[model samples]
Target chain A: MKFSDFFRKKSSGDVAKDRLKMVLVADRSACSPEIMERIKNDIIDVLSKYVEIDREGLDIKITQMDGEGEGSDGRTVPALYANIPIRNILERN
Target chain B: MGEVIVITSGKGGVGKTTTTANIGTGLAKLGKKVVLVDTDIGLRNLDVVLGLENRIVYNLVDVIEGNCKTKQALIKDKRYDTLYLLPAAQTRDKTSVNPDQMKQLADELREDFDYIIMDCPAGIEQGFKNAIAGADRALVVTTPEVSAVRDADRIIGLLEANEMKDTKLIVNRLRQDMVKRGDMMSAEDVVEILAVGLIGVVPDDENIVVATNNGEPLAGDASLAGQAYMNICRRVCGEDVPFLDLDVKKGFFARLFGK
Candidate 1:
C-alpha cells in the first residue's frame, strides 16, 4: 500500500465500479447474500467433523475472474471463493 | 425476408422509443422499406413520438385479434415515403398479446418490409417477451446510470437464455462533460460492464426533446444525437461507419490555444 492511497479520495466512478462488480457477481451466480450465509453455515457444520476452525474469521464470497475456454473473449466469469481459518486438526483413532 | 430488430431496455425512460423512431426513419431515408411497430400496448407512445398518433385507426391488438388486416393498422409516415408504423392499442394492455402473435405478425411483415423495428416497453414482462419474439436481433438501449446498466445486464442474460444470441448495445444520453469530471460513467465504462458489441453512443443533447416534441425523428438532423442515430442505422445495415468524435470541440479549442 502507498502512503498517498489513504489520503486520496475515490471518484464516484470508482465507487460505482466497485459496487457494480460485487452486485454483478451475485447476480450472475444467482446466489444472494442470504444463500451464501446458508452455504457458509453448512460448510462450517461439515468442517467441524474434521477440524477445529475459527467460524467468526471465516469468509466466503462470490466474485469474478477471467474466463477461459472457447468464446471467452477475455470476459470475466463468476467464481466462489472461500477462506477458512483453521485452529487444529481433529485426531481420529 | 426482412430483418426484425427490437429496441429494448429493461428500464423505462431510456430512449427506446426515440431510438426506434430514428432508426426506422433513418433506414427508410437510406431507401429501405421500413416498418416501426409499437409493442408497448397500453402505454403506447411510439405513435406520439413518431407523430402518427392521430392515424392509429387499428392497432397491434386489432390485427392480432383478427378485427382488421395487418395492412389496415400500418400507418405510413408523413415525411418518409418508405417508412410505416404499426401503432399499439391505447386501450389494451400487454396481456392482450402474446409472443406467438408477435412472431406471426413479424413473419407477415417480413414479406413486405425490408426492415421491421419493434419499440419494446420497459421491464422483463410479457411486453418485452412479445417485442423480442419476432426480432432477428436486439439493440439494448441504456443510459449511463447504474440502474439502467444493471437492468441492461439482466435483459442481456434473459436474451441469451431465450436463444437470441445476436445482441448489441446502444449507450444513450451520454454526457461527455460529466464523464470528464468523473461524475458519470463513460461509454467505454458501460460497454466494459455490459460486455456487448457497441452499436452507437448518443450524446446528451436537448435536440432530442425538440425533435420528439415536433413528432419527428432526429436521424440525419443537424444535431449530435441525430448523427449518432444515423451512424447506428448504417451499422445496423452492416455498413462500416466511424463513430462521431464527441471531443471535437475540446480538441478544436486546444488546437486554437496550442495547448
Candidate 2:
C-alpha cells in the first residue's frame, strides 16, 4: 500500500515460519527432498507405461493440508501433493 | 495420589531444570505437596538449582539400588515445608535406573506428594526414556529458536509414539520486545509450527539467572517471569487462568528515562 513498504525486507519471524513449514513437512513425512526426487523418477517410469506426462512441468512436494472426516476436527495433516501435466492417455486393451 | 509430570527438552540449556524447580516450588506454595525429581543421572544439577546440594546424603540411585529407603533419600526443601527433592546420582549414568524402577519409584512417590515434577535430561536416549517412564503427562520445553523448536517437534513425535499423548508445550525465554520488532518468533508462532497445546510463555529475564545464582526459584517472587511460572502452576492444577499480557508497551517516562 505504501511506496516504501514494497521494498522492505522480510521479517525474520516470517522467515523462520517459512523455513519451519518446509522443514517440518519433510520431517513428518520422513521423506527428504533427495528421496522425493528418486520417488518422482519411479513414478514417472511407471506412469509412462500407459500415459504421456510432461516431465518438464512435473511438480511434487509434501505439504500441510486441512483434515476432514471423523476425529480430524479441522486439524492440519501432512499430504503429498503432485501436479503431473498429462499429455495423453493411452488406450488399454 | 499425585500426578507425575516430566519436564523435558530435547536440547540442553533450555530451562528444563529451572522450570522444574520453579513449578515444584510454585505448587508447594499453593499448599500442594510437591517433589522434584532430577533424572539427569551423571550430569545432575537440579539439586544445585534448588539449593539442596549441601543436603544430599542419598540420591535416586541409592534408593533404586536398595542402599537406602526412599524416605531416607528425599531432601526436604529449606524454603517450602511441602516441597521435597529426589536428586539424581551424580556419579552414576542413566543405565543405573531402568523404566520399571522409575515406574515403581513414581508410584511410590505418588502416594505422598500431590505433584511429582521430573526434570528430564537433554536428548533422546536412555535418560529421556527413563524420565518419561512413569509420567502421566509431559511438558516439552523449547525456546523460540528454530533449532529448539525442531528438536521439540521431534520430542513430541517420540512422546506420541510412546503413547504419551498428554504432552504440552512451554515456550521459554521469549523476548517480547524482540518479537514485537519481528526479530524473534512469538509463542503463537512456535505453537502453530509444533501443533501442540501451549501451557506457558516465559520471557527472557535476568531475574531468572539471578534466582538461579541465589538458589531461589522465581515462581512466587515479584517478577514478571515469576508471575508467568505461577500462572503455569495454576494451569497445571486445571485452573482456567489466562496468560499474562506480556506485550504491554513501556510508559512514556520509563522509555524517556531508559528505565
Candidate 3:
C-alpha cells in the first residue's frame, strides 16, 4: 500500500513493469535492495579491504526475472540478478 | 500488410542494434523492401553500425515533426539494394518523440516497405514504449548472463501488458566455452527461464567488433556465429531452423576449448 502510493502517479504499464523488474531483481540476488544496502555499508566498514569501491560506481544487481515470453509464467528463474559493475575498466586501465 | 518489429532489450549492449542491422539486411536481401529505424534517440549508434551515418541528412525527429518527407529522412543502404535506414536524432532526447507519433511514422513507412525494424533503446522507459508502439511484434534480445536475462524478462512482462503478444527472444553474445565448462548458463537454461520461442543464439565473436568497425554484418558469412545469426534471420521469416548446440561433444582440444 505504501509502495503503491509512491508509484501512484505512474501509469498501469509503468507500475507493472516496475514491480516486475524490482521483484525479479530481488529474486535473482536473493537479497532485497535493503540487503544490498547493508552489504554496501559493511564493505564501507572494511575501509582497507584491497581496493575501494567508489560508491558512485557501485552497481549491484541480481537476476530477478528474465524475459521469458508469454507462456510458462515464472518457469525457471536463473536465481541471480547478474550485474553489479564493480569498476570502470577503461578508467582503471 | 507490412510488419513493424521492434528490436529491444531491457539491458544495454546486448546487441539490439546489431540484430536490427543484420535482420534488416537479411530481409532486404530476400527482396523485401525494409526500413530499419533507430529509436534510441539520444544515444544513436545504429547509423554508425549500418555505415549510413555519413549519409544521414534527416532523421526520425524530422519525419515526425513534418520538417522533412519520410524518404528524405531515410538513408538507403548502399550495400543492400532494398534496405533503408531511418537514423535517430542524436542531438534530440527521447521526449522528442511519443508513442502516437511513432505509430504515425510507422504507418507512413508501412505503405512502401515490406518490413519495418525498430532498434529500441535500453530500459523500460518512454523510449521503449515509443519503439514498441507502432510494432505488431517485438524481438527481445538478451545474453545468457543473469543480468541480461533478468532485464529481458522484465521487457517481456511489459510487452505482454502492452498487448504485444508476438514477442520473441534473441540470446546474443553467448560464450560457448563457458557453457561447456558449466561456468555459464546454456541456451536450454536461458530458454527454460524466459519461456519464449528461441529465435537465435549468437556466439560472442571478435569478428563482430571488426564487422561493426567496417560497417558490415557477419550474417552473410559462413562463420559459426554468422551462421547462427543467419539462422535467426531465417526464423524471423517464419522458417523452422533447428538450433545447433554451442557446446556439443567434440575432440580433445575442442572439448577443452568449448568449440
Candidate 4:
C-alpha cells in the first residue's frame, strides 16, 4: 500500500503470475472485473427508478451451474445471478 | 500402437518446436521409433530446427492429399536411425489440413512408430486443434515467465475441454541463477501455478542456439538442455527418472540436510 511497496524488488515473474491468476478467474466466470463493476452500477441505476433498495447491500456474481441432468457430460455452465435487497417500495403519493 | 504426444504452448517462442525435436530425437536414441510432426503449416520450423530442412522433399500436406505415402513423406534423421520428421508444408496454410485428416495421419503412423511428437503452432487456432486431435497426451511447454505460464494454463484448459486428460508441463528456458536470486520463477513455482504434472525443466543454455542453428538438436550431446530433454523422453516412456539438480552451487549444509 506504500509507495515503496509498488516499487519493491519483487520479480516480474511473480507479479505477472499473480495477475494471470486474477485474469483467469475473471475469464472462467465469463466476465471481467471492470465489466462486473459496470453491471453493478447499471443494475443500481435501473432499480433506483422503481423502489428504494439497499444498494450497498446488493451483490452480483457469476457462478458455474451444476449440470446434473444435462446428459452427464460433467461440464458446468456459467450463469449470472444477482441479489438486490429491497428496504422499501416507494409510492408516488 | 504409437502414442501420439503433442508439444504445444498457447504462446509463441516458448520452445515447442525445439522441445518436439529434442524429445523425438531423444526417444529415438533410446531405440524407440519416433517421428516428429510439424503442424505449424506455413510457419514450419521443426525441420529447420532438426537440420532436416534440406531433405524435405515431401511434407504433411503431400501425405494428407494422397500425393505421397506416409513413409515417403517422412524424412529420416541423419543421426538417429529410428528418428524421422514429417515436415509441414511451407507454401500451404493451416487450412490445407483439418483435425480429421491429422487424426487419420496419426492413426496411419501409429502402426510403425513408437512415439509421434507433434510440434504444434502457437495460439489456440485451427492448427492447435488439429495438432491435439489425434494425440493421446500433451506436453504443454512454457518458460519461467508469466506470459508463458498464463498461456500454458489456457492451453491446458483447452486440452482438458477436448478430452485430452493426460497433460504434462515442461518448463523450458529456466535460469537457475535468476531463481537463486529470486529474480525469476523456479520450476516448482511454475508447476504450482499451472497445477499440472511436471515432466522436465530445461535450463537456459546457449548450446541450444548453436545446435538448432546447425540443424542438430542438443539431445544427442551432453549439454544441460540435452540431458533434461533426455530425461523427459525417459519419463514419456514410463521411466521414473529423478529431476536434475540445477542448483549445483548449493551450500554444503543444504545438500547435507537434503534441502
Scored by lDDT, the top model is 2
Task: Candidate 4: give the clashing pairs.
Answer: B51-B215
Output the better candidate (1/4) by DockQ. 1
CA RMSD (A), model 2: 2.7
Query: Candidate 3, which segments miss by more than 4 Å at Cα?
Result: A1-93, B247-259
Q: Report how far off residue B1 is in candidate 2 (Å).
A: 0.9
Tens-digit per-residue lDDT, B1-259, candidate 2: 9999999999999999999999999999999999999999999999988898999999999999999999999999989999999999998899999999999999999999999988999999999999999999999999999889989999999999999969999999999988987789999999888989999999888999999998999897878899999999999999988988786578999889963
Q: In DockQ terms, which candidate is top? A: 2
Instruction: Give the lDDT of residue B18 in candidate 1.
Output: 93
lDDT of 3: 0.80
Name the 10 consecutive residues with the lowest summed lDDT in model 4 chain A.
Answer: A70-79
Per-residue lDDT of candidate 3, residues B1-259 (tens digit): 6889999999998899998888887777677899999999989999989887889899899999999988888888978888999999989999999999999989988999889999999989999999999999999998877678888877898899899979888888888877654556767677766778888888887888988999987775766677788788788889898986665346898669753
User: What is the full ranking by TM-score, best candidate first?
Assistant: 2, 1, 4, 3
Q: What DockQ results for candidate 1?
A: 0.62
lDDT of 4 at B256: 98
For all the models shown, what interface RMSD does each have?
0.9, 0.6, 13.0, 1.9
Superposed by TM-score, candidate 1 places the C-alpha of residue B95 at a distance from the truth, in angstroms, of 0.6
Cα error, candidate 1, residue B234 (Å)? 0.6
